[model samples]
Target: MIKTAILVDGAFYRKRAYTLFGDISPAERAKELSAYCHRHIKDEKEGACLYRVFYYDCPPMNKQVYHPLLKRAINLGQSEDYVWANDFFKELKHQRKFALRLGRLAEEQAHFNIKPDVMKKILSGVKTIDELEEKDFSLSVTQKGVDMRIGVDISSLSFKKQVDRIILISGDSDFVPAAKNARREGIDFILDPMRSPIRDDLYEHIDGIRTKAPKLEKQNVT
Candidate 1:
């Protein structure tokens, strides 16, 4: 049996798992994950020791942007700072300063202006910085903490010689160096890409790669 460690990327897993299960309960998801790993592992005939599962991802910023309870659970304190930065960015866009005269030109035209009589046209379909709701999101934000967390833990696990094999669930090319280092230390490195294409270089170096989800029909979500 291969001694295995499963390190799942939170950003990758959360989005894909939601697509599969439509729910975010980690405990419920863990059972699906464990079963999935068991099926794809290369040396299952020899049995396998699942060391542990590590999931990494960031938190959401706007509560109104997601289901209320989910928002409360998933949001991090840094989200408030990011939300404030987004609001300021919108305000700056409305101000339309610098050498650019795009907004000014639009204002000079008869098609654009602020007049009480034109309020019907403006308010009917137009939206402003202050008027925008959660839908006006401009930031492509994630919790931002997951990467560091993953890196720290991976190093620790390797240094401790915790497992003979390691499976990483990510399509981000960022993990290439770490994966390479893991191999040098005698750990079998495997990549599990959940739709996001794996880098060609990464494909060349890893012991194996997994793309298809393991037998879901055999196991149902509890």
Candidate 2:
């Protein structure tokens, strides 16, 4: 059997899951993620075996920051998002053959910004800036060390021959270099974008493209 390592971009998976599967409890989400990973291993054509599942993500921000729309400082640690994220991470740790690679949020650079759609409306004169509300804004923060960690792991896996196949679950082109290197080492590199459209050029870098999970109907717009 071909040993396969499944690498997940946590932010991308979470967004896609929310869009396709709607809101679910953290424990349920973890179980779903494990099932999704296992589906790839059970592919009869590849005869893949489970090596490990590496999930890369940043811990939730737990700092106090001033909200421009609210005109007050908000403690992010007390937010429901923070609580849910912690719970989700805890649940993931309990899964077999699962490895969590946590990066960190650039807390000092964290700030609230208008949502992209809201900003577009304002710029196009469809909505006035004076009409902006708290709901139109969202906290923006940069994720540090995530891409680097992924790159390093890919290099290590390739050099050490830990797995014959590397299946990355991300849509970002930033991983092109790592994927190229892994392929050079004779590892079967596959890209799983979770049904999201990828650039035409991206096909040249991977051995295959596969998404085992079925997309569910979106229940709500959040």
Candidate 3:
């Protein structure tokens, strides 16, 4: 039987899981994700044996900063969110045949900008910044080098022939070249979009698609 490997895009899976399961703890989320990966592969095995699972993401920044929402400088490292994320990583590390590939986050100076409509209302003397929601302006940080690490790993795995099939759990189109290369190397490439829509062009690179059922959106509002 051919060996199959699974690669997870941690950020994407986390967001989709929240939409599916709601505001759950990281440990619970990890548990469900682990089951999903294994179950999905087993269902799609087509006579292949499970190889290993790889998860790629950057670590939390957990830095202290003053924000418009909090109105004070706070240490994110001391926050509940950081604690949960650390715990989640630990859980994954302990899982069988699971590898965690971590990337570093780079910080930059940024300021929250007022929305265009909010600015127009202010210019017309109809509203003020304080009248708007704090969420309207958010301080943002970007992840660096994560994509490169994923691409390099894909290339390495394909070239080394560690597994005959590779299952990538991501929606990013950046993996196109690597996927094409792997296909040329006679690897059976499959994609799992977490029940998300796949692009038209992406259909050319993969052998098959599989995903868990996404929860239906609740639209009723009181």
Q: Could you tell me which residue pairs clash in candidate 1? A: 10-56, 58-143, 59-143
Better of 1 and 3 by lDDT: 3
Stretches > 4 Å off in candidate 3 = 69-71, 109-128, 135-139, 218-222
In candidate 3, what are the lDDT values of residues 37-86, reduced to their tens digit?
A: 88866775467677888898877767776776557776768977678788
lDDT of each: 0.56, 0.92, 0.78
- Give candidates' CA RMSD values in order: 16.1, 2.1, 3.8
> CA lDDT of 15 in candidate 3?
73
Count steric clashes of candidate 3: 0
Superposed by TM-score, candidate 1 places the C-alpha of residue 135 at a distance from the truth, in angstroms, of 5.7
User: In candidate 2, how many Å is residue 10 off?
Assistant: 0.6
Regions more than 4 Å wrong, model 2: 215-222
**Which pairs clash (backbone N, Cα, C closer than 3 Å) in model 2?**
none
TM-score winner, 1 or 3: 3
Worst 10 residues of 1 by lDDT: 98-107
